[model samples]
Target: MRILLISVNRERMPYPVAPLGLAYIAGALKAGGHDVRAIDLCFSTDIEHDLTRIVEDFPPDAIGISLRNLDNLTYPSSLSYLPELEETVAIVRRRTPVPLVIGGSGFSLAPLPLMRRVDLDFGVVGEGEGSIVELVGRLEQGASAQGIPGVLIKGEDGFIPPLPLASFHAPDRSVLDNERYLKEGGMANLQTKRGCPFDCIYCTYPLLEGKKCRMRGVGEVVQELKVLQAEHGADYIYFVDDIFNYPADYTAALCDEMIAQEAVVKWTSFVNPRFLTTALCALMAKAGCQGLELGIDTGSAKMLRAYGKGFDKEDVARAARYCQEAGLPLAVYLLLGGPGEDDATLQESFALMDRLNPTAIIVMVGIRIYPDTALQKIAVQEGLIARADDLLEPRFYISPLIGSERLIETITEAAMKRQGWIVPGLEINISVPLMEGMRKFGLRGPLWELAGRMRRPRMRPLR
Candidate 1:
């Protein structure tokens, strides 16, 4: 079987993320004895021409399209990728009569709505690696893919819950242009684990990957890092894990393995504030972790509980202090304007950040609500959205008390006063050209340190 996997993510704002999920699916297909080829539309200048050329040249038996994101997730300036995905699907449908399958984190989040919108033969929910291989095998046999786990038939009522994989497959980097990602994006990405045990209200990670953390073998992770460093010429790696620090024993062992194997790759990951410790931070730093991106969300005690964050303000500050003491640059992300957000909670967040003084503070005003999330339920209860809403189009949860306008204004005012504060919703601190120039100058990792160094004009208070 010849499988053509296409990644339709073209958002290159902060940085272009290589389609690691698509690469994993391609690897699984190859391991199943199928000829797999991939097309990354991230850097494609002419999508129609590229799709035509690839279809005519390879002429695949099955086509799999990976949708990375539903939207930019930035409120006020939110951009949807559905149009591009629809266009790509239309082009492929015109080019080939083969079966069109859609999967990836974006598609997995709302498979039913997406399957209805896009003309696709199948949709794989949750993880694609195992399900894709099974679906392909069933297709090859000309059998009904009815019972396959995670495989959703077009116009189906409901999807089968994705079965847990016994083991994970290594991603096939050779299937895509990895060097370009490393050069253009400044870092290669790999996953140390799947699943998120945290219960954040606005997060879809647990739905996409089960709540239980399924860690990759530490040795396997280290080897992939060495390969990324050696073969791909990637000096930096970003662990695309939900929470890299959770299950502290596993993190410690992974770091120990990386050190023992001399992986020598500078890395960063989304660290959880609740689980981080001084010892773990030091171990991570010793294992060549260049920085940490803490998803602290908010610093107010009330907002923390409202957001269903397990960590409190003290934990956040402790996490920041530990990272700083370990000599690791820390980037903190705050998702303001959730359910109970107001002037007091917002000020608490700013005050806490001022005290902790992280390397960078990336602030997003509104919470992008997705279906099947706690936030979705809250939105429905509050009459923000109907219960039957599929939420295919981007809808955000801004507190009715504060409203979007005042929320943005308050954050923008506070961000302008702080040196390291970055409000992406208002486009205050970061820009694409600036990031490109920094990457061109050989900067790597999250590059939050450099972003923190950029100056912001302080604005006077409105009387």
Candidate 2:
């Protein structure tokens, strides 16, 4: 069976993402003896032409489109590229009659309605490796897709039973042999584990990955790092796990293995605030971990409870202090507006930010409601949404009790008073001329180009 996987993520944020999910699925299918190829729309200039050519050349038996994100996942708005995705789907459909399956970070979060809108034959609810392989096998065997686990069919009477998550070794990077992309500012991403133990209600990770956190062996992780460093010349890595420090001992062991193997690649990962301790921080730093991103979503205890963030306010502060004392650069991520978040709670968040003063703080001020997540339930119950099934126009941002715009204003005002605090990229109100100038030149282009004149460096006057 020949499988063609399409990654429908084109917008690149400040961070570097390598579309590991799609690559993992391709690896699994190939491992199962099925021919597979991946078409990434992120770097592709002409998606339609490229996809058409691939279909004509490869003539895949099944097509899987990985929806990496719901329009960059920026708060206050869910970006929609439905028309573009639909067009790709149409092109694929027209060129070949292969089965179309949609799965990825975004589809994992909102599978049902996204499937309805995109006109995919089916979609995997969560996790693509096992489900994708099974789907391909069933289709190959000419078996009815009726009882396939983790798969959804159009007009199906009920939801498909979720498949038990599969535990596999670190992905075979050899599947996508070219490692040059890693050296070109892309983080060699690795997921050492899946799922989050902490019940952060606002998060979609726990819901998507399930409550039970499954991990790959520490030795396997070390081996992958060694391969990346040696074969790929990967110097920077980003662990995209839900919580890098979930099992502190396991994390420490992995760090030790990396150190033992001389895998001295600079790395960064998100760690749960409550679980991280001084020892853990020290171990990470010694293992070449350059930075730590902590999910200190809020400082108010009430807001924390509302969002089901298992950790308390003190836990965040302690974790921040520990990371700081351990000489690790800290980046704190916070959500500004959501249920039970009021002016006072928002103020407390800022106060805590001022007190902790981590290396940087990122403020996210939008609520995206997925079907199964707690936020979606709350949205439906609060009349913010009509039904969970009506995912056609994904709606988010519940500021009715306080007003979403007002919330943004307050957060912006508070953020402006502080240094090293970053807001959502989409929300930033840059001048149109400046944005046009950025388009003329690359992101790292000289400011003098946009300034309309280059002031040559002048030798300082002799004093």
Candidate 3:
């Protein structure tokens, strides 16, 4: 089968993210002896024109498009991206008759709603490499699609039940954006595991990879890192795993194996604050772990519990200290306002921020409710939202009880004082080229400039 993979993400908001997910799927299909081509909407002069050219030239047997973010334009600030997506799809449909499939981190969050809205022949609900490979094979052989896991097929009857989640091989790094990633001076993204056990209300990981965490063998992980270093000259890798700290023994063994092999690639990963300790931090540092990003969504334990985050604010501070002690940079992720948030709690968050003093603090506002999260239920019960379809784009809030006006004031006052906090809504950094790009496209102007200056560097909480 000949395949064409398109990444439709245009928002290079923070960093120039290459489409590792699409690259992995492309690689898997190619490994299975299919021809593959990739196109990123972000790099094109005109996405429609480039997409037309690819469909004409390659004439793929199947087409896979990734929606990394549904709203490249942020929520509350902007609305539905379906129009942009629909426009892209129409152009592609006009050029080719290939099966249209949609998958990505963004799409995985609300698959059913997206499937209904878009003119897709099928949709991959979660990790797409294995599912796409199987779909292509079945389509090639004219096999019945009834039993394929993780596949949502369009039929005259209506959308069919998606296939059950199927087990498959881990993605090899060769499948991702090598040249672009290299040119951007970015680290290769590797997933040592799938899924997350923790169910933070705002998180989309569980919806995409399931709640039961699965790890690749330590030997497999080591071999892949060795290949990345030797073949691609990749000295840095980002473990795009949900929780690198859970199943501590696996993490330790993987680190030990990397150290033994002298595969000293500097790596970063998401760490669970509760599982991290000083000894574990020491082991990670020994293994050449560069930094860790902790999802400390709130400094208020009440807010944390409301969001189903299983860590306390005190543990968050301790994890930051431990990572810093072990010579690791820490990135702290903070969610500004959600259901249980109020002025007092947010003030406490700022006080906690002063104490933690991470390398950087990312303050995102509220949770975006999708079809599967507990947040969706909460959204309904609280009358914050009325339906699942509200997730067509990033419909979000700071919460009425917390009150958007007050939340913004609180964030503004804290950011005015905190040198280490980076608030995107506030736009603290003026010179980030991505901001320039957004301005060039008429997204926003001096407002973004204000945001740039107010933003702080990224902080890591644990190794």
**In order, how many clashes per candidate?**
0, 2, 21
User: lDDT of model 1 at residue 124?
Assistant: 92
Worst 10 residues of 3 by lDDT: 443-452
- TM-scores, all candidates, are 0.97, 0.89, 0.88
Q: For candidate 2, list the clashing residue pairs, or say none.
A: 76-366, 399-403
Best by TM-score: 1
Q: Candidate 3 on 1-463: residue-level lDDT in tens? A: 8888888876655545667778778778888899888887766678778888878888888889898877743433454566767888999999988899898877877677788778998888777777788888899998866666677777433333444244445554554566565445356677788777787887777767777877778888888888777877776787877888888888988988988988877778888899899999999999988778888888887888888888898899889889989988777778777887888788788888778877667677666666767777777788777764547767675677767777777776776566656666555332256444444443311122233233453222201
| Model 3, position 126: C-alpha lDDT score | 73
- Ranking of all candidate structures by their TM-score, best first: 1, 2, 3
CA lDDT of every candidate: 0.88, 0.73, 0.73
1-463 per-residue lDDT for model 2 (tens digits)? 9888887776644523577887788788888999888777766788889988988888888898987766655655456767667878888888887789888777766666776667788888777788888888889998877777778887664567676476866664654533434533245788898877676666777767777888898888888888877887777788888889988888998999988988867888888898899998998999988878888778888888888888888999899889988898788888767788778888888888889877777777766666666777787788878763555455665557667778877876775555556665333322234434454433321121122121221111201
Local error of candidate 2 at 206, Å? 2.4
Best by lDDT: 1
